[model samples]
Target: MSNGVDRTILTKEHASGTVDRDTDLETVLRNAGRLSPRDALRYLTPLISVLEGLHTSGQSHGSLSLDLLRVTKGDDGAPRLRLLKGRPRKPTLQDASPKAALAGRMLLYSSPEQIQGAEACEFDDMYALGHMAYTLLVGEPYWIEEVDRLGFMALCNSIIGGAPEPPSVRAMRRKSIRLPHDFDAWFVLITTRKHPDHFRDITDAGIALTSVLSNPDIRELSRSVQFKFNPNILESPSSAVPAAPENLRFTAVFTIVASISLAIAIVMLLRWTNAQESPKRDPSLQSTDGAPATSNPSSR
Candidate 1:
């Protein structure tokens, strides 16, 4: 579908009905009833794993956007969702925001000696999770209304420089959406610490996260999913594949052309040789020319 198309974002027509800024959050919540809190957690858990994986690899979802998220109902009547944001060559909706731009400057220009391995990666995941939490609680995508690219970056740098805010804080500030009382605790539980509360270390963190998904409530809800494939994987089928030697395709074409030409030459040589061969004359038969004088009438 992306055949040379520079598609950065896409939206779907509302299946249930039209939604607007004035639409009551309650109505949206009612429609979203199909997905329960447990279901939402199911989706979020795997997503946490995905984010962790991205962080470990020294990558971030450069193009994180609402379209990258998906929601579906599970067999148990709980609604689950899938979040798939791949690192992209083009700026994602967030990258266009002022927050992303400022964050980039501070990351690139600031003194590097103070930063250590995994710090940037962790911070990147932290902010990304913040955005994710905001979307989850709001039951829709969240974006800053303005597009001051530099200002956004600055905002991100400010957040990263100071204590990270709970999802509740961001929600209240950005969209005036308040979250459950436990919201802060949950946010801290998921994003702040290197390990989730249950896990003592990375290995335990992984196991604990996996165990949470196994919870019946979470399992029922994390069904509907969406994501963009990483562009790096799209480049070629295999990583070990070396770039084709210079002009390899061209060389192949030339080889085929030469073979065809050689075949034509051989065919022409055979035709010419046949043309040069002469038919033998029959001596017993009388010739029409004057040189055949010994010709006699056949004995009757």
Candidate 2:
């Protein structure tokens, strides 16, 4: 574990597959391996499992892009989704290079909150997963068109403030790109009808996306999505990634402060009520003289 007190060596295996056999998910998407909805679900199910496993191990794969997905055959000679690149490195402040902040890859795939200097958490991963889902379903990188034409700040502004068009719409616009029959329902469920201005977290949009992707058919997917929105769900329970201790401590302190403030407010409120209900001395008689004294109502 990195103590962040000294230099720690880190390594990432640079997971572009060997030249002869395997190809990245992006290349496949561009070519014949492009996924239909059913296939996309099939592929994403494993990816979610792998992501959960990473988080459970107290690591988040901060970088998840289309290129990180590798298409290779499993031991049984079936196609498999092998995720690669960026083993769980603790996000160090030193790595926050302004030059690399909005690099081309990030512009298209990074989460909205992440671009704003928020540390990458499972929520950020899930948000990026949403775009990845879009790329797979729509058979094209999500923001390629906009990024190609715009400047860096323009791209940043758009990703941060702009509303997203559903992937189904984009797929429909391309005559060559054919989406699956149930793609619309799936996209709508995942998006959760985002407000005109706001970002989505796992508690809201991410859980629905996760639930739907983990299931097989649209009917089952719909049910799973519905389950996440149910009041009884309480909070998102399957967050495989644990928050860092510092973050947890911060949350605890904030909660304590909030509770104390609430207690103080309640106490003050009770005191105010008691004062209102209790007997009040006549204004003039409040003086040493118990006899009433005349004074203008407006006088303090």
TM-score of each: 0.34, 0.52
lDDT of 1 by residue, 79-177 (tens): 443444433233222453435543453332111111222323344444444445445556643333222333554434333343334445545755566
Highest lDDT: give the candidate number: 2
Cα deviation at 285, candidate 1, in Å, is 99
The window of 10 residues in a row where model 1 has the poorest summed lDDT is 225-234
lDDT of 1 at 118: 33
Tens digits of per-residue lDDT, candidate 2, 201-237, equal 3334434444444443455433333211211111123
RMSD per model, one decimal: 23.2, 17.4
Q: TM-score of the candidate numbered 2? A: 0.52
